[model samples]
Structure formats: structure tokens, C-alpha cells
Target: MPEAHEDNRPLIERIAADIRKKIMSGDWEPGRKAPTNDELQRLYGTTNVTIQKALRILKAERFLEGRAGVGVYVRNERPQTITPAHYIEPAAAGQSYRWLTEASKRQQRGKYRMLEVAEVTPPVEVARAMRLEAGGTAVLRSRIGFLNDQPAELVHSYYPIELARGTRLADRRLIPGGSPALLEEMGYPTRSQDDEVAARPATTEEYVALELPGDVPILEIFRVVYSDDERPIEVTVIAKPAHRFKMGYHIELP
Candidate 1:
């Protein structure tokens, strides 16, 4: 350990470095319990707060996880692949694969609350993407998605109004279960969807609506759905909390 200094490095940083070295050197393995605060205090002669700071740093670095009631344990393995932004094709469509519904679990951090829905004039971008005439009206569905009961994602879905008009679906409050499965039943099959991911700072609306931390980045997903003729019919934008969603994609190489 370097000599204790007053000005330069933080105690947590130094301790984190030492712990990292031990793991990198194979002194500790995956799934191993990290030294508790008491153990760390004994080993390093540090206070509980200092040890906790070090552990929190390691956890943010993906080196450890706390199991609620259980002790902090090392991650068993790093994700084999980095999450990628990709399109999802539903099975009823010609696409061979559908996203596993089993994998899509609702998080309690944010409440999935619908804000509003109404027939609105489609914006130029939406018109072009959905192949609708300018000045055409579409059904807009807006919702606030929460994590840990905290707002996290602001979701807005637009569909051609004719398809959804006169139906109770036009009212956001009338929707149930948070999934738009009714569209499929209406015969406008969602064959496939295209997703685009971009990194950017959160806007003020996002920060407040999603209840995001100031320093955390946001993952923006723009998804376009195509119909049987390959015409884009719907557009949905998902503003997700940075640390919450683990996106992944796979590609087959010949």
C-alpha cells in the first residue's frame, strides 16, 4: 500500500485497486463472498464507512452484487456478449423467432402508468416512418414506466388512427396489463420491429419523468413496426434507465 496522503487519492479508490488486484491475480474467484465490512476493517484497519465506500465502488464496476439478505458475492461471470440494439420479430409474422416473453418481467422500481392517449396529428417524422399522409391523425399512447416504483422510461407509441379509432384503446386509462397485444388481435399483425439505440444525456423531461439520477446516462430506443407488406405502421420510443435494462443481440455468421 502507498503511504497515506491527505491530498491525492481517496481511501476507497486505493482499497478498490487492491481488491481488484487480488481478484485479477486469481486470489479470489467468481461467486466468492467478498470480505465483509468487519473483515475489511480488520484487514485494512479502516472504518466501516471507508470499507463500505470501497465495496460500493467495486459493485458499480460489476465486480460484486449484494443478495438482499445474503452477503455480497462476486459476479459469477461477466456477460458473454455486450448487449446490442436489435429488431424483434413476432412469431405470427414471417420472422422465425420471437422474444421470450418469459424474459420480459416488470420491474417494480417504476410504475407502468399511462399518462394519456388521443387522436393527434402525426408529426412529419412519424408520418414518413409510418407512411401516412401529412396532417393525418394517429393514435398516441403515452405512459410513464417505473422502476422500483420510481419512474424510469417514458414510452410513447403511435399508430394510424383509423385502426384504433372508436375502440376503447384510444383511452390510455382503459388499457390493461401494459402490453399492446390488442393490436395483434385487431388484425394489424406486427410482423417485425426495428430498434435503434443511441447514447445521449437525458433531457429535463426525461430526468423528471423517468426519475433518473443526474449523473446516469439514458438509453434511447426508437422502434418501428412493419406490417405484412413491410410498411411501417407504428413507432414507439422507449427512454430507459441506464443501469436497468441489459440489452443483448446475437448474429449468425456463415
Candidate 2:
């Protein structure tokens, strides 16, 4: 057994780690039902609540899944194999977020559903994320993006159009282009960012766009991209069917 952490780890995290070890070591094979809560409590010497907490973490990480009325089981695909951990840098082929954002606003070859595009007063969190004063006017863009007529993803993007003057973003034709690239072209290049990813249930819009059944789960990604000058510019909330999309990243070690 590995030495325990000097600091007490969260019960869920510790349980999650042990379960991950079993899966990685092939002690638990894909599609195999993990031990029951009572069994886990015995094995880990913990309470049902602790076991549930751990299982929830695994579920969120896509390592395991629960069926209604059925017990938890290892995912059909090895989580490591299906979970996206790599990011691919698109060819420096001149991408523009403005154009993409605008393109998304327009109806292209793929089917689309615009939830709402009303100018509204942003909440404090939105204002903080966009670096704008609270209650300021902003454009709320919510739409379902599709490929081959299949719902690929749902995008909720907020922009400070009040600050973006003399740009194409206001025109709403942004497509096949990237919003980050567009900002760069408009003299507000995105230099760095913070992002978070987790598995979640489909919202009403997501279900309609993805044609998702009640049981199907979706992946949610929250991204905030900013400029080198430390100014916040874009906050995008994305939702996609689990198997329909993949996230890629490339990291270099020093």
C-alpha cells in the first residue's frame, strides 16, 4: 500500500484514487460492476456517504456511471482511453474568434437554434468574468451548433459589445473562424486563460439540440480567455454529447 498523505485527504478523493488504481491495474475491468456501497464501506472501512461521495467524483470524471435503479459500474470504455486530456493547437492558419463568434450567430450549412440574443444586464459573476461593471449592458449569445445536422454542441457566449467597436463581431457572420483569433486581429489578442471541465446532465436546450435521451449525459466546459494585457474578453460555456466531441491539448515539459 502507498503511504497515506501527511494531510488528511478528502474521503472521496482517497476512495476515488483507490478505485482508479484498481481500474488501471486491471483489477477492475471495463463494464464490470464495482462493489456495492455496503461492500465498499466494508472494504474501505467507511460510511455509505463516503462511498457515495467517492462514486460521485468518479462519475463526474467519466470513470464510472450509474443507471437508474441499477448499481454503479465501470464505464464501457476505459476512462483513460475516452477522456480527452490533450489539446490540439489549430494550424496557425489565421483563426479568428470574432469571425467564428459571428459565424455562429448566423445560420450556416448546419442546423441551428438560437435560444436568445437579447441585450441584458449581466450578473455580477458575468460582469466580473468579462471585466465589466456589474449591471452593464452585454450581448448574451445562446445557440446550438450542429455538424451534419447532428447537434455537436451548445454554446453560451457573452461579449462586451459595448467595448468592441469597429469590429465584425457586431455583424453576426462569424463562422469557421475562431473568436480568439478575431480578437487578435481586432488588436485584442487572447494571451492566456482559465478553464474547467466536468460531466453534467443536458439542459433543455442541449437535449433538444443533441436529441439526447433522458439517460444520456453531456460534457460541460467553461472557458475564460483573456488578453496579454490582462483584460478579460470572452466567457464561453459549452455543452456537448459525451461521444460527439473530444477535447485536445498539447503540453511541453521544461
Candidate 3:
């Protein structure tokens, strides 16, 4: 419990803010029990309903979790960091999975299930990004990536059907060194990438696929990889649960 704010802000909001700060500042360790409801009530000198409301706010933010018979505790939510460098450097041939190499470096296991591979009419945006004509077919590689056994991301990659024909990208199995390496071998080495990121409510499919909380939003990334000639080689649309990832970037100022 904490002292109520002197301002007109709701008492529950003030109490939640205090507890949030404590948790973020490491005053409360993950998986450790948070102050009991009765204790919070006493600390804030507030009613039981106010204390409960405060706890509810923290729980919704995934900073806390309540047990049935037990008490509420801080949540052990570890966010994976994503950086541009991960995609810039293609993994070597005969190496571990390229798409997950970054996670492996962070000591987190990454695995993905290839949901489907088919040649279909590309979505409007995908066609525009990949420079394909309307109703043109593209090879679609759909996958779901998991981190520590939890669903983490949904990736849908589209490639020119002619370019991927008879290639592993059209195969149902996972590519040995990932698509980037294979593209390089085919003389379409990725020279640069463009990424557009946005945050929005998770769709039904995304929510179910990522197993995200109802209140959590999704981070959508539209990435285009280009060849030396600046031709778009591939377009990948990625959806990730907002709470499970932290995007990072390091720029060198000229």
C-alpha cells in the first residue's frame, strides 16, 4: 500500500501506479508474492474495493497474476528483444536455423511450425510490396514461431512463384539455413531491408494463433528484403504479441 495522491486522480489509479513503480523498480521480484489485499488496504488506507481495483489494473498489464487459493504474485514476463541486425546478417549454410539464431544467442529456445506452403493470389498489399500484378500467384510460406514453448509470432512470407518454383521455399519442411541463405545461393542475395511497424488490436486469427491475452495488442511488421539491384525479393508480414517482444535499434549518426 502507498499514500493516496493529493490530486483528484482516482484513488485506485494512484494505488496502482505506486505498485507498478515498485514492480518496475525491482522492489518486487518476479514470482514473489505481492502485498496481500488486506495489507494493501491498510497501506493505502482505502476500502477493499479500491485495493482490488488496483490489483486488477496490474494484473491486466501482465505485471501481476492472482492464484486461486494462493495470493497474487508478480508475473515472470520476459520480453525478447528484436533488432535489425538479426535480419541483416544471413546465417551460414549448414548452421542452426537462421530465423531463430538471435533468440538462441539470448539463451532462449526458438522453434517454428510451417503451417502451409502454397501458390496463391497474393494479398493486395503483398502484391504491391512484391511488385506483383493483380491476381498474380505467389508462393506463400506461413509459419508460427514459438519461444520457450509459448506461441510468439505469426509470419507469412510471399515470394514470386516463378522465383520460388522448385525451391525449398515452396517445400513444406523448414529450410535448413533459412530463405535468406537460399536466396543468396540463387544469386538474389539480400542487400537491404525495409520494415514498417504498427501497433493495433489483435485479430481473431492472430489472438488465437499467438494465444495472447484479450487486452493485449499485437505488433505488426511488414518487411521487404531487396536484392543488390533494389528489386524486392521477398515480403514477409509478421505479427507478434506486444507484451512478448521489445524492438530495438542502433543507428550510427553521420
Please tell me which predicted candidate would have the highest lDDT against the true structure. 3
Best by the TM-score measure: 3
| Per-residue lDDT of candidate 3, residues 78-159 (tens digit) | 4556786676666787886666887787787999998999999988999999888778899999999998888989999999
Model 2, range 1-254, lDDT digits (tens) per residue?
99886948887788888897777556889899989999999999999999998888788766788988988998775432222222212214453333233334444334455666656666576677887765577766677776546566788777786645335544455433455555666677766777787887777777776777434578888777777677778777778776434455666899
Candidate 3 Cα outliers beyond 4 Å, as residue runs: 1-29, 32-47, 50-54, 57-62, 67-70
Residue-level lDDT for 43 in candidate 3: 94
Q: What's the C-alpha lDDT at position 19 in model 1?
A: 84
Regions of candidate 1 where Cα sits further than 4 Å from its true position: 1-111, 174-180
TM-score of candidate 1 against the unseen true structure: 0.58
lDDT of each: 0.67, 0.67, 0.85
Q: How far in Å is the alpha carbon of 177 misplaced in model 1?
A: 6.1
- Residue 5 deviation, candidate 1, in Å? 33
| lDDT of each residue in 53-102, candidate 1, tens digit only | 88887777566788888899977743222242322433443322122221
Off by over 4 Å in 2: 1-116, 246-248
